[model samples]
Target chain A: MLIVDRVSKKFNVNGKEKIAVDNVSVKIKKGETVCIVGPNGAGKTTTVKICSGFVSPDSGNVYYDSISLLNRKKYLEKISVLFEGIRSINWALTPLENMEYLSGLRGIKKNKKDIEKYIEMFELGDYKNQQCNSLSRGNQQKVAIACCLCLETDAVFMDEPTLGLDMEISHKIIKILKTYAQTNKKIFVITTHDSDFIEEIADKVLIIEKGKIMFEGSCEEFKAVQNTNTFKEAYLKYRGVL
Target chain B: MKRVITVFLNELKYSFIILNRYRINWMFGLSNLFLSVLFLNLGIKSFGNYVTENVLDLKLTQMIIGLFVFIVIAEGLNNIISKITQAKQSGVLEQIIVNPLGSKYIFVIKFFADFVIVFISIAIIIPLTMIITSKIISFNIYKLIILLIPLLFCTLGVGLILGGATLVFKKLQSATHLMQFLILTLMVIPSYPITPYSFLPITVESMAINKVFSSQISLSFGLLAFLYAHSFAYFILGLLVYSKFEDYAKTKGILGHY
Candidate 1:
């Protein structure tokens, strides 16, 4: 289980104090896929950054099981993150080399079988040896996803994982993430605006706006909040559009 | 310890793979280094007979040693800052920062790997320079190595300081270039027994290399120990300052920002 307790962060923009994340808290159980949906500047990315220890919170702590994430080695060992809108992988390296090298950084020795499995799963066998920069954007996204998932950490935080992906690739990734979450008992906290992704993969949904969570519940309950069946309708009704 | 070694080797391998992929960049960088050395030699030769023969020869040797020291120290000091800046702009800095093995150690390993690559380039450049200039420069290989190892340690420490500043400051290219210029200027100052220049970074090492090559003075154990001590001190200081800057970056949530 992962718990984020009363986390808050403030940033200075244009020499003015701006609250990016404010007194937010969340708890996610193992094997659960939780999607955070919000408008622009809703503090979703900041929250993920804080939990991943890339950013420090001003007033809260994150924990895995019963251990505080202040312990960097344990925190890093248990979590992996994919930041939004960036080429996180080394552009100069082939996808296979990146997988091996990144996993090696965590002290995880991937066997040949594991390498082949990821290759087949991501359909990267054809492009595994190509430099990531040479691959198409969707393929590059797949490689980045594979590199992160290959770590197999207990908690995975991904921000906008399907940002530039096409419908076909996005669905494939959604299916892979759904199955991975189901079988591995890992906690996935993703921030996205993709309704299909949320409908297909999220077990629970968090609606955040203006640095505060407006709603938090199962998909069914979230839709029922507006007495609707479709996630789009429910979201629109909640935002006073329907 | 084993994990550290693995990270180091993996980083080294990754660097080599990248270097191989960008062979053109490698070639160009080598050409640049070679041209610098060649021009310096040619320029010195053009100044022949301007001074007494003995004085001219001594000045040439000193200048060559000074230039060589500048190159090595520049590599040691600027490599980390450049790596950090590149990583930051490319969005890979955060990934490395969140490594379970600790990002700082990974960078140090990266520096060591880069140093190895630089050393290889130096090996190639040395002979090429020697061949082209017909300058069979000679030095006590053992003493030179002894002097350089610690000097690299010190330069790397200073590099870490600049690298740490790059982390927080985010735009330090001009500052680093200025620093490189300052180091180049310092390289020209001859060693003195009790001068303030002796205490500046790399000054002693530069003089010591000149001493070994010219056979002017024998290096004592005390002096060698002092070099080691000075280098290690800067290295430790660099690590501490880097950690502090890293903390500030994390607090500011600017690790991924420009």
Candidate 2:
């Protein structure tokens, strides 16, 4: 479980301070899948970064399973993050090589069989020997996901994981994530603007506007309160639109 | 400590993979070695005349050692500056920034990797030049070892500062040009034992060249200590700047912004 307590972040631009994330708070439970939806410049990414320990909050603390995240390696060990358009693996390395390298970093002991298992599971066996840059976008995304899952961390934070993926690949990724969450009891927190994806997989929805939480509830409850037929309607209504 | 070592090893492995993938870099290394050897031959041909004219007190062997130091420092600085710029352009910088590794670890690994590349070049070029110019050049193993300490540290320090600056400015081409200019100036202004003008030139030349091959190791040690202290200070300052601006860089959605 992750608890974010009144986290805020600000940036200075030309000697002026611009607040990105305001004093916002939220709680994510284990075995729960939460998706945060927001418009452009809505600070959803910043919130994800804060929760994942990539960006330090100016005013609040993040807790992982009741442990202070500040200066704590155990909390970090429990979390794995995938930022949008960010390739964490070395481009010169192959998919299998990247996986083995990251697994070594996480101190996971595995031999050739284990590595091949993950490669086959991700349907990346054909491209396992290909350099990362040579792979297609969807295949690269698969490799990135494989790297994260290889860590097998309890909590996963994905920022726009489906960006630029075609419908078929997108559905495949969603299914993989859902299966991972359901089978392993993992906590999945995704920040994306895609309402269809949110409706499909998000058990709970957290809506943010201009850095503050506008609403938080079960997707069903959110739909009921807004009297919407779709997640888009609920989102628009919560933002004070007709 | 084990974690630090782990980070170091990983970085080393990554560096080798990246460097080996680029066939051009190896070509550049070979060309650089050939050029250094050519210069050493030219210096040897003129050495006797220079000593006969009472222009130099040093042997051709010492001149060759000086040339080796120059080649290493030049190649090291150029490789580092260009690599940092390329990393930013190629999105490698973003990948590194998001990792859990600390900034100090990144800086140290980068510095050491560049140092190793330059060292390897020296190892290859120096021996080849000595073999070709066997009659003119002689090896002083102890002096060579002593010379390496300061030269490595000085080049490492300069490389770090330049690499960090390139991250902020993203004007590596101009920065590299300026670095070349500075190195040339440092080499030429030190006059060989000829005149008062030669005094400043000789002093600068001796300082630059002796740091890598002189028998007196203490001066080189002191210079290395100074370089390290300054390099570390700049490294910390650079990290602070990076942390301060990183969020802005991310929000602006410009990973390779100047």
Candidate 3:
């Protein structure tokens, strides 16, 4: 289980203090996929960074399996993160090399068969040996996401994972992630604006705006917010855009 | 312990891939080093026509030794900042900084990997320089290797200091270039038996390297001990400065930005 207890972050811009995450707390049990949906600058990325042990939170602590993440160096071994707009893997290296190096960097020693499983699963067998920079943006994103899952960490945080993916590949990813979450029993936290992704993969949804979470609940409960048949209408209504 | 070893091994593989992929660049750099050494030797030897044969011979030998030390130490001093800047531009700096073994360990592992490459390049360049200059100055292999331990530490220390500064303030090309010029000056300075300039970074090590190659001057135990102590001091200071800068970068959340 992962617990973010009242985490807050503040940034200074041009000598003015701006709150990025405002006392936000969240909990995710093992095998659960939680999606954080928010507009740009809604602090979704900051929240994810704090949970992933990349960025330190100012006011609160994050606990993974009841162990505090604050000042805990080993906590990083248990998590993997794919930040938005960042390839997260070395572009100068091939996908296979990246997988090996990244996993080794994280202290995991997976066999060739286990590593090749993800390579084939992502349909990257053809380009696994090619430099990642030579691949198309969608394929590059696939490699990045595959690198994350191949680590087999206890907690996986992906920010805008499907941003550059085509519809076909996006659906394939959703299927893969859904199955992976179920079988692995790991904490999966994602931040994206893709409604289909949110609807299909998220067991729980967090709608954040202006650094604060406006709503948090199950998929069905979030959809029932406006008595609507579609997740889009319910989300629009809750965001005051209807 | 296993994690450290894994990180080290992977770092070697990663460095190898990069080196292999950019073979042309590596070759070009090696050629550049050779040509620079050749030109430097010829430039200094131009005055050889006026001096006595023995004086010119000694002068040229000292010049070659100083240039060799300069080339070797310069690689260690310049590699860390270049590596960090390249990683930052390529969007992989954040991943490296967040390595589970801690960023410090990862950087050290990378330093060792780069040092291996540097060592190999030097092995190639040393023979090439000797053949081109027709100066077969034999160095004591044992003493040379022993002396390099402190020199490598000094290089790593300075590299870390520059690397930490790069974490917060990116784009340090001009600064690094200036540093290279200063290092060149400090490297070629005449070594006094007891001079205050020995306290400067890379000075004592350069003097010691010159001594290793010069048959006339023998290295003293006190000098070797001082070199180790001084180099380790810089290493420790560099680690502290780097840690502070890393924390500041994490606080500001600019580690991934350009």
Candidate 4:
């Protein structure tokens, strides 16, 4: 379990201090896929980074199974993160090479069989031998996700994992995440705007706006709060589109 | 130790991959090196008599050693800043920093990789250079290498400072370029028999290198002791300052804002 307690982050831009993530807190349990749904600039990524310890929160503590993340080594060992829009793998390295590099950093002696399995499962074919730059955008994403998932951590935090992926690949990823989270009892915390994907995968939903959590509950309660039957309608309500 | 080795070997693999992927870039870079060595060699030979004349208060061999030593030193220093900026813009820096092994390991390993990649050129450039200068470069090769240790450590120390700045400041290319120019200028400055300016970062190391090759008894143990002390000093100072800046960047939430 991962616990975020009163996390807040502010950024200074052109002499103005902008609050990026307000005082927000959440408890994530194993086997639960929590989706933070919001429109752009909703501070979803900032909150995730703070929780993941990539960005330090001003006045909060993140505890990994009751241990403060100030013990970064233990905390990081238990979690893996896939930040949005970053080439998590170097462009010069092939998919498997990137996986090897990341695993080396994570201090994992990755088994060859597990690597081959993930590559095949993610449908990364001969492109695994090619540099990430040569892979299509969708395949690049798959490789990045595959690298993170290969870590076999207790928790995973992903930002916009399916942003550029085709529906087919996106569904494949969703299936993998569901199976992994269910069977392994792994915790997943994701932020995305894909309403249908979230509807299918999210055990709990958080509607974030302007750095504040507007609503937080089970998916059914989120839809009930908006008085909507469809996840898209509830998400549209959160985005102020409906 | 095992983790460091894994990081180092894997990062080294990536450097080879980069060299192969960016053929045109390496082509131009290698050509530039060849041209510079050619011109420097020809220019020195053309001025062999005047240079032997000790017109600049130094021997011709001293100039060659100074230039080559500067080349190696600059490569180590510049590698840090250049890669930081490149990784920042490519968004890889964020991912790298978030890793459990920490950013320090990654950058240091990458630095070793790049240094080795650059040294592959040195293997060719050195002999070609010695041939150009007519091989009057007889001295303690072992001593010369050992003496150059302080220069390497000092360069790494200062490189970390500037590299830390690059992490936060983002557009530090002009600053780094200016730093390179200043470094080259300082290389020659220490050649002047000045006493008071001995305290500058690389000044002592440069003078120590000159001392090692001159084959003279001015062999002050004082300079050698200073070399050891200052090497550790600059390295430690650089590490401390780098960590401070890194922590500040993380707090300000700009660690990823390329």
Candidate 5:
């Protein structure tokens, strides 16, 4: 299990104080997928980054099992995070080369098979050997996501994992995550705007806006908000977009 | 050790790939360095040179050798900032730091990889300079290396200080240039027995190198001991400064901003 307790973060952008994440607490048990959805500037990415140990929060702790995840090495080893943008992949190298170096660091030996599977699944076979920077934006994201998948970790955190992916590859990823989560009994905490995909995969959902959690409940309960049958409708109704 | 080797070997491979990709860069840089050395050597002739009252009593051949030593030190120290800045801007530093092998080892591994490149280039540059000037100055390779070793640690220290500042500010080009120039001036200052410039970071070490180069001393144990001690001091200081700045950046939540 992974637990985020009362985490809050603030930043100063151009001399103005801005709250990125405010008093947000979340918990995920084994074999569970939790999805966070919100509008732009909702602090979804910041919260996930904090959980991944890349960004530190102002006040709170993230715990794995019953112990505080204080050791960065131990925490990073246990989790695989889908890094966002160029921060995830080294543009100086190829997708395969990155997998080799990065996976080697993670002590994940012989990850070529895993890398090849994702390359084939995402139709990245043509771009695998090319430098990551030269690839298109969508393709670079694929490399980042593929690198994340090379780890056989206990928990996975991804932000906008399906963004920029084609529907075919996106659907394939859902199936892959579903099987991996089930067989490994892993914890997954992801944030994305894909309502239908969330409806399909997420056991629980968080609706957030302006650094606050507007709603938190099971997927079914989230869909049942305002008597809406679809998650899109529930989200629209709850966010006051209707 | 195993993880370090893995990272080091991979870094080597990438260096090779980059070298092969831009073969002209190597050729251009070498030719440019050769020209600069040649020009300096030739330019000195127009001055109607006179002999020195210094300790080494350097003739033209000796002067060439001494300048070449300066070049070697400069070559080694010059790349650390640019290489680190490149990695930082490209997000390579951020991505690699997260590796399970830990950030500290990765930094050292990358340093060794770059140091290897500098070593190879210097190896090539010396022969090319000697051939270009047609100056035959004999010195012990082992002795030269012994003296040169301390400068590596000293320069690594300087590199770390600059890298630390880079970790926070991100736009330190002017500061980096200022430091490079300062290092060059300090490194090449005329090291006479009476010059009194020995307090510079590499001054004593460079004097040792010149002594070995002109065959004035036979690889003295006292000098080597001094170097070994100072090398420890500079390297440790560098590590501390880098770590201090890294800690500050982490606290400010600004490590990966650039």
Candidate 6:
């Protein structure tokens, strides 16, 4: 389980301070899939980064199973991250090379067979040897997912995992993630504005507005609210737009 | 300690892969080879003219030693500037910053990688210089190796300092050009006798280069040791400055500023 306590992050823009994340606290239990929904600049990415220890918060702390998250090597090893950008992987290397290199970094000392399993699982077998830059956006996302799952960490942080993916590929990714969550009991924390995807996969939903959590509940409870039939309506209602 | 080594190995692996993928290593090697030949020819021509004119009583081996020092300094500075600039452009800088490793480790690995590349170029240039000018110049391998160390340290130290500056200024063009010019002046001005200029500038330049090329003193090894110590001092100082500025850099979102 991960607990975020009163975390705040601020950045200076042209000598002016802008708060990206307010004093917000959240707890994510083990074996659960939580989706955070927010518009652009709503501090979703910043919160994700703080939780992942990529960016230190201006105040408060993050604890993973009662241990401070700052500079904790063991905690980091248990988490895998896929940031929003699709080009995070080295584009010059072939997909196979990329996977091999990352797996090596993670101390996976196996050969082609183990890597081939991930390639087949992600449906990337045909493009396994191709350079990442040459692959289509959807295919590149598959490679990124394969890289993340290769580590097979207990918890995964995916920011906009399905961004730029086609419907067919998106469904495949969701199905895989659902199956992984059920079988491995891995905790998946995803931040996205894609309500359809969230509705399909997320067990719980947290709506954030202007760096604050406006609402938090089960997806079913969220849908039971009047005019909350769609994730978009729920988001709009939380944003006070309706 | 193991984690530091792990991060170091990762950086080295990534740098080697990137270097090969972009073909920069091969390009740098080829260019260094071409320039070393060109410069050696120019140095030989100038030395031959000096010998005919009876301008100095130095042996051919002595002239070759001087030319070797000049090439090492020149190529060392060039390699440093280009590598740092390319790293900035390649998004490697930002990637290193985000990792759990400290900035000092990143700078050190980058410096060592560039230093190795420069050292390889120097190795090639030295042998080629020996071959092409063998008829005119003799070789003293031990003296050559001894003279090369201080020059390499000085150049590497200055390169890292400038690289840290690149992170601050976010553009390496001006800093790199100025460094190249400064290195050239340091090499060429000292080749002439030290007495012709104003006493102050001459004294300053002489002391600075001597500090860099400490082995020239030929006394106890204290001066050479001091030079090495000072090189590390500058390296640490650069690391500190980079670490402090990195916080501001993150706020400015300047990790990708280049």
| DockQ, every prediction | 0.66, 0.24, 0.60, 0.59, 0.41, 0.25
Model 3: per-residue lDDT, tens digit, B180-253? 78888777666547588887878888888886677666888888888899889988888888888888887787
TM-score of chain A, all candidates = 0.96, 0.92, 0.95, 0.94, 0.86, 0.92
**Order of models, best DockQ first:** 1, 3, 4, 5, 6, 2
Once fitted onto the true fold, the runs of candidate 6 whose alpha carbons sit more than 4 angstroms away are A72-75, A103-114, A237-242, B1-25, B52-95, B110-119, B135-169, B172-177, B183-219, B251-258
- Candidate 4 per-residue lDDT over residues B91-157, each given as its tens digit: 6676677667777667767777787787786766666666766656665767767777778788878
Model 5: runs farther than 4 Å from truth? A14-16, A105-114, A164-185, B45-79, B137-139, B189-200, B216-219
Model 2 scores a TM of 0.80
TM-score-based ranking: 3, 1, 4, 5, 2, 6
**Docking level for model 2:** acceptable
The top-ranked prediction according to lDDT is 1
Tens digits of lDDT, candidate 2, B64-92: 66667567667767766676666566544
The true-versus-predicted C-alpha distance at residue B194 of model 2, in Å, is 22
What is the lDDT, from 0 to 100, of the residue A225 in candidate 4? 77
Clashes of each: 0, 6, 0, 0, 0, 0
Q: Give the fraction of reference interface contacts each candidate recovers.
A: 0.64, 0.05, 0.53, 0.51, 0.26, 0.04
Better of 4 and 5 by lDDT: 4
Candidate 6: TM-score of chain A is 0.92
In model 3, where do residues sit more than 4 Å from their true spots?
A84-86, B189-194
Evaluate all candidate structures by whole-model CA lDDT and list the values in order: 0.83, 0.68, 0.82, 0.78, 0.73, 0.65
Worst-scoring 10-residue span by lDDT in model 4 chain B: B51-60
RMSD to the true structure for each prediction, in A, is 1.9, 5.0, 1.8, 2.5, 3.5, 5.2
Query: Which residue runs of candidate 4 sit more than 4 Å off their true CA positions?
Result: A238-240, B51-58, B136-141, B191-194, B214-220
Worst ten in a row by lDDT for model 3 chain A: A80-89
Name the candidate, 4 or 6, with the larger lDDT value.
4
How well is each residue in A7-77 modelled by candidate 4, as lDDT tens digits?
A: 88888889998888888888988788999988788899999888777888888889989978788767877
lDDT of 3 by residue, A136-189 (tens): 887788788888899888999989898867898888888888988989898899
True contacts kept of 1: 0.64
Q: Clashing residue pairs, candidate 3? A: none
